[model samples]
Target: MTTFDLIIIGGGPAGYVGAIRAGQLGMKTAVIEKASMGGMCLNWGCIPSKAFIESAKLFKKVADAKSFGIDGIDKKALKFNWKKAAQRKDRIVMRLVKGVEYLMKKNGVEVINGEAKILDKEHVQVGETKYTCDKMLIATGSRPLRVEYKGIDQSKIMEIDGFFALEEKPECVLVDGGRINACEMALMLRYTGSKVTMVTESDSLIPFLDEEIRKFVMDKIKKAGITVYTKSEITKDAEDGVYVGDNFVECDVILNAKRRRAVLPEMGDLELEMNGHFLKINEYMQTSVPNVYAAGDVTKQFFAQVASAQARTAVNHMNDIKETLDYDKLPVNIYTDPEIAYVGFTEEQLKQKGIDYKVGKFPLSVNGKAMIEGETEGFVKVLSETKYGEVMGVHIVAADATDMIAEAVMAMRLESTVDELARVVHAHPTTSETFMEASYVAADRPVHI
Candidate 1:
C-alpha cells in the first residue's frame, strides 16, 4: 500500500500493538520495522533472560531437593548444559516472534521490513518507496550503551547479544551493570557454577528498587556467592586483573547488563523535543507535532507494558476516544532471584511527598504455601494512606511476586481501598493471601505476623 491511515515506525511492542488497535478501529495501518519483530524485549532482552532464570532456578531446586525427599541428587554429578539451555531460550524467542507476525496479519496490518526514514510527518521512506500516512508513530526503541576500559583483552567484554552467542558458560566471569538484566545474569551464572563477580558504577545496586527489597536482594545475592562491588572503578595495570576499587577481579569474560539510551534514527530535518534522551510526549502520547506521536523506549517510559499501553492510548486519541493511562500506578517488575515487583509510591516517595501512610508487612516464612514449597524467604509489604485507607503501593519479594502484583495493580486502577481488599475473600494457603494479611496489618488488626 502506498498510503495508510496510520504508519508506525519500529515494529516492537509499541508499534505492533498500536497497529493492531488501529486496525480493530477500522484504520488502515502499516508498521515498518528495520530489524526483527517483537523488539528487544521479546527477542533477546526479556524473554531469553527469563528463560535463563528458569533454568538457573531449576538448578537451585535440584541442589535443595534433599529436603523435599528427592533422593540421589549427587551435587558433584550435577552439571548445567549451556548449549541445551541456549537452544531452549532461542526456541521460546522464535515462537513469540512468529506469534507477533501472525498477529500483524490477523489484524489486517501491513508489515514492511526495512529501516524507516521519516521524510516528514506525513511521509516515511524505506529505500525508494515513499509511503504516506495521515498520522505517524515513532516507536523506535533504544540501543545498548557500550562501556570501554583500558584492558589487555577487550575481546572478553560482551554485550547481551555477544554473551547469548556463547556455546557454553565462561569460567571466572566478571558481570558489569547494576540493572535488572545484570543482576539476573550474575545469579544465573553463579547457579550454573561460574565464578561470577559483579561490578557497577551506580551508587546503589538496582537504584529504583524499594529500599527494603534492595537490602533483601543484596543479602540473597551475597549468600548466593556472587561477589558484588558498586561505585567501582577500573584501576591501573592492564596486564592481569581489573581492580574494582582495589578489589582485583580476574575473569575470562565480562558480561554487561543492557544499559540503553533513546536511540532515534536519522529523520531528515524533523526535530523532536527531548525529555533527556527520550522524546517528550503529552498525556495522550502526542509529540510536539500533533500528528506525530511516540511510544516505547523512544519516549520517556521504558517498560514494555507501559509502551504497549501508551501506543494503544495514542491510537484511541487518534480515533477521538479520549483515554489516558494512570502514570503513577504503572508497575515496575524486576526479575531477580525469587522476584521483585511493585506499583505506586515507595516509602521514600511517600515520605518525600509528606503523605501520611501506614505499612503492613507479611513474611512468606509464615505463609502455608511458601512453607510447603520450601521457598519461604520473602515478604509482602502494603502501604496505604491512613486517612482514606487507599492503597499507596504494594511491594513483594517472592517466587511469584510478579504474578501477585497484578491484583494490587487492579485494585489501584479501580481506586480500591485496603479495607476493600482486606474484606474480599482470597483463596487460602496461597502466597497472594499475603496481600490480605498485609492489608490487615496496615489496618492495625494482624491475623498473622
Candidate 2:
C-alpha cells in the first residue's frame, strides 16, 4: 500500500496549482489527471479560444489596414486561413501543457495518468490501484451544459470544445446562453465575418455586471453586427432553421455557452454533500467529509483565476495556515473587442445590500493613449462609499482592461479610498490614467474628464 501526504484529482488549474503549492510546503503530493494536464482552460477553453480571437482580431485589422496609413493594401485582396489559425492554437496549447508537466516534475509532484475515484475520505483509487493520503483534494472541474430541443442534430449543435475543433468557419451561427463565453464567441465569430444570432435565456447578457457596464456591453454587441435575442431560447428545429418560440431563424451552426455542472467521478458510496449540481464547500474549500476538499468549477467558483485562488486557499487550510476565501473581491474579465474587467461590489449588489455609494467615471475617448491607438470606445467607472470615500468597486471597458483590473483588486484588498487613488501620481499619456481621472471626480475635483 503506497501512501502520501496529499493526492489531488484532476490536473486542471485547480488541481495542478494545488499540487504545486503542496510541494512548496514540503508535502508529498500526487496529481491524477484523466486527460490533458492544463485541463479545459489551457487545452480548449481559454488558450485555444484566445488564440482564435487573436487571429480574428488580426484579420479585422488587416481588413482595415488603410486606416493605419501604412500602404496601398486592398481589403478585398486580404485573406485569412482558418486551418493555419487552428494549427497555431494547437501548437500554443501543446507548448503550455509541456511547461506544466515540467513544473510538476520540478516540484516533485507525481503525475498519475488515470481516472481517480474516492474509496474513502483518506483513500483514492486510480485504475485498480488504491492509494492512501493524509488529505484528498477534488478538482475535477465541470462540463458544458447540454439542453434538449426538438429535431436537434448532434452534428450541427456543439459546445465550446466542438467550436474549437472546427476546420472551417460556418456561414452562420446560432448561439445559446448569456454568459461570458457566449459573448466572447459571438464577438469572435462576428469579427471572422460569420453571421451570428445569439438567443439568451436571461433578460440581459452577463447579467451580474454593473447595470451601466452591462448596458454598454449590450450596445457594443449590437454594434458589432451580432443580433441578440434576450429572454429567449431555442425551442424547436425546422428544415429552414431553429425556432425561438414561433419564429424560425436560419443558422448553420448552434453553439451553447458556459452553463456547467460539477464533473464528480463515480465514488461508489463515499457520501459528499452537493449543492445543486456542484459540490458544497466551506470558506476554506473543505467538504463535508473529513480531510477532503473541493475547488474550482466543481465548487461554483467558475473563473480560472478564482479556481486557482480557491485551490491555494484549500492547500493553506490543509497546512493549518490562517486564510479564508472571499468571492466578493474576485476580479472578473470578459474578452470582447474592447475588453471589460471589474472587481468588488457592483452597483446592483450594493443597491440590494443598501450600501450608499457615489459614482465616478472617465471616458476612454479622452485618454491620450486611446486616441493614439485609435481604439477608444469605453470608459473607467469607480464606486465609492458616500461617507468614507473608500473604493467599493472598479469597472473598466477598454482594450487592456483585463490587465489593469489587478490594480483595482489591490485597492479594494487594501481598503484604499478614492482620495488616495486621486492623490497618487499616474504617468501621463496612458490608459491607466483614466483610473486617476475617475478618482479625481470621486474626490469632488474634476480633472481631464
**Winner by lDDT:** 2
Q: Candidate 2 lDDT, tens digit per residue, 304-400?
A: 9988899999999999996997777889988988999999998888899999999999999999999888779999999999999999999999998
The worst-scoring run of ten residues by lDDT in candidate 2 lies at: 146-155
lDDT of 1 by residue, 1-449 (tens): 39999999988889899999999999999999888899878886778888988998998799889999989889888889999999999999999999999999999999999999888778889988999899999999886676666754677678864567688789787887877778888888898899988887887678877899888888888898988888885554344456777677888777767477786867786787888878999989999989999999998577899999999999999999999999789888888878889999999999999999999999999999999998898999999999999999999998899999999999899988888988888897899999999999998888887
lDDT values for all models: 0.87, 0.89
TM-score quality measure for candidate 2: 0.98
Look at candidate 1 and give me any clashing residue pairs: none
Candidate RMSDs in Å, in order, are 1.5, 1.2
> Least lDDT summed over 10 consecutive residues: which range in candidate 1?
233-242
Q: Return the clash pairs for model 2, or none.
A: none
Candidate 1 vs. true structure, TM-score:
0.96
Which regions in candidate 2 have their CA more than 4 angstroms from the true location? none
Question: Quick one: best TM-score, which candidate?
Answer: 2
Superposed by TM-score, candidate 2 places the C-alpha of residue 180 at a distance from the truth, in angstroms, of 0.4
